[model samples]
Target: MSSSGIWQPANDFRRVVFWRHGRTLWNAEQRFQGQADIELDDVGRAQADKAAALLAAVGPARLVSSDLRRAKATAQALADLTGLDISTDPRLRETYAGSWQGLTFEQIADDYPTDLLRWERDDISVRAGGGETRIEVAERMRDGVLEALSGVESGETLIVATHGGAARVAIARLMGLPYEYWGTLSGLSNCNWSVLQETGNARNPGAEGSWKLTEHNAGTLPEPQTEPVED
Candidate 1:
């Protein structure tokens, strides 16, 4: 605790809430949507509405989303509540999965067994369906997020409405995790979100600091924890 009882680091760091869009018919069908621009289903709309209300309490200062339909729709739910304009970025879109984009999990597994296994193992070099490598996705996701953060001032929050894969890689990239460790983070469920706070260490002024994962795959608001900090 600081002398003034303030979380002093709050002034130095920025909070980012990375939210996954709601479910789509493709998602329910276990098909890969990738950057296919699928819309949310009925249940997805309800989930977005429910999640938006809870997230609004966080008082986000900036809202950004992928240019894809599902992600745009998800961002709109929160925009309607907060009256914040949604800034769309194609770089924030899901990885372009090429031949695997519209295929079901079973289909991909049956057809591209080797590639699928590599992907599942988080091989940064393997290009799924001969598409973007995990490193490529992470690079773009990192660029998009850093661009969004440029507009956000210290002590304010930025909400990124993006896809599950994009969100995972982005979070991992922001936290400075190795590409091999990216798979350790679980995929987010529909309409769930994760939170990251900047570490505010001594680094280049314009460079983003290492971020700490504060929350992951959360459907409900984060509660204060009084547990002892582990080494």
Candidate 2:
């Protein structure tokens, strides 16, 4: 652990940052994107440019992104600064909200109230729009992240550009949180990111330790964790 009471990756360890894509028209309009393959709007491009500068300073070694245009675009910004090749993975795409794609929250509430409620409740079996459940998404996300991390060397940082919902679920799974408690973690805002430090070699199958969430929904660089003090 570092002096800030937060665990920092040692020379033998690695770090992973899950970055959410910037705002799209649907995102700005409060519509459910859910693997719709939307591109970043003008404002989103600006957001990515700013964020890429900061993230680039940290010296990320590799970039992996969802195959969707929005995520690919966001990763491209950081790649431009870092000069790292981007690897796109379809498994990192947002939850496929089958019939619910392209609808607003209000529309889903009115049309599929029960399913919406179940989704909000984090029901593992509840598949919004007859799409994959949270568990399914989590599994695929875990696999994709692990596959990407396999190439990451110690003391290196791997950045993942993905959608908000996909990032949250993957974070929860990577942290070993149960599916029902996934909602406890706040959602990521557009262009914000979460950081996870490896406690063990999660890249190796059946590794000893889990990935610990060091930061969440952050626009700035990570700060030290505040620990309790004794008088």
lDDT of 1 by residue, 1-231 (tens): 333221223455788888988878888788878888789999889889988988887778999999999889999999999999999999998888888988888898899989888887888888877788888988898888888888888777899999888888888888878778887888788888888887756143234447888788887524221211000
Alpha-carbon shift of residue 118 in model 1 (angstroms): 0.3
| Whole-model Cα lDDT of every candidate shown, in order | 0.79, 0.80
| lDDT string, candidate 2, 1-231, tens digits | 543333345556678899988878887777888888889999889889878887887778889999999999999999988899999999999999988888888888899999888888789899968988988988898899888988888888889998888888888888878767788887777787899887755555334247888888877434221210000
Superposed model 2: Cα runs more than 4 Å off: 1-11, 200-209, 220-231
Q: How do the predictions measure up, each by TM-score? A: 0.88, 0.88
* Native-referenced Cα lDDT, model 2: 0.80
Query: What RMSD does each model have against the real structure?
Result: 6.6, 6.6
